[model samples]
Target: MPDCIICHLEITDPNNLFECPNNHPVHKECLIEWLQHSPNCPLCNEPYSLETKSNLKSDLDKREEEKKKSEEDEARKERNNQIKIIAEKIIFLKFLNMIETLIEKKDFEGALDRLNSIDENKLETVKK
Candidate 1:
């Protein structure tokens, strides 16, 4: 029923609760965020135990690694999307040039047939 000193909120989950050596209550999540900025307990300003600091540091490192991997995945997806867009544009341009060549040869029906064969969704994406 004790409130976490870091967040000023009641500790509802015993499993996620942590206490300083002075018995000051804090939420585990709150302590992790706090530890990034400060090493000492917010309420008592006392240094946390070496084991506690080590565990927190390991958790923080894992969080950082996960975040970096997520960012890299997102960047790779964006790059692939850009490549897809470029490839689509190349295909569309080539189709258009082929149609132009047909028009120059007075093959109006061939040009119209080629235009009609295109997917509407591809046309919409190019328009956007």
Candidate 2:
């Protein structure tokens, strides 16, 4: 059994085997990953054919697009969370200001009523 030079693992599947111009064998998956870093073979330093490089380049491009999309999604979620937190804080501050105005007017009953109507869950989110 021939071993893939890139992974030092046995080429279990003949269909998954790839060879460089010098006939150095490597796993197709490993070579695809390796191509991202270099265009040359790991063993012989020979460049892969244009067709092989083009196919591998296409695969690498798809992987990069997927990675970028995933990162963008994560960033958008983080931004939304930050926006939500800011909105909550703004609401909480407005609620506090209203209470303060009531206290200044000697309207203790109104302030107490407003405090009672406060949503505890929303207050907890602001606290965090």
lDDT of 1: 0.86
lDDT of 1 by residue, 1-128 (tens): 89999889999998878888898989888888888778898888998888777867888777778878999999999999999888888888898899999999999999999999989998888755
TM per candidate: 0.69, 0.70
lDDT by residue (tens digit), candidate 2, 56-98: 7777787778878999999999999999889988988998999
Off by over 4 Å in 1: 5-9, 12-24, 34-52
Error of 2 at 26 (Å): 4.3
Native-referenced Cα lDDT, model 2: 0.88
Best by lDDT: 2
Instruction: Report the C-alpha displacement of residue 60, candidate 1, in angstroms.
Output: 0.9
Error of 1 at 84 (Å): 1.8
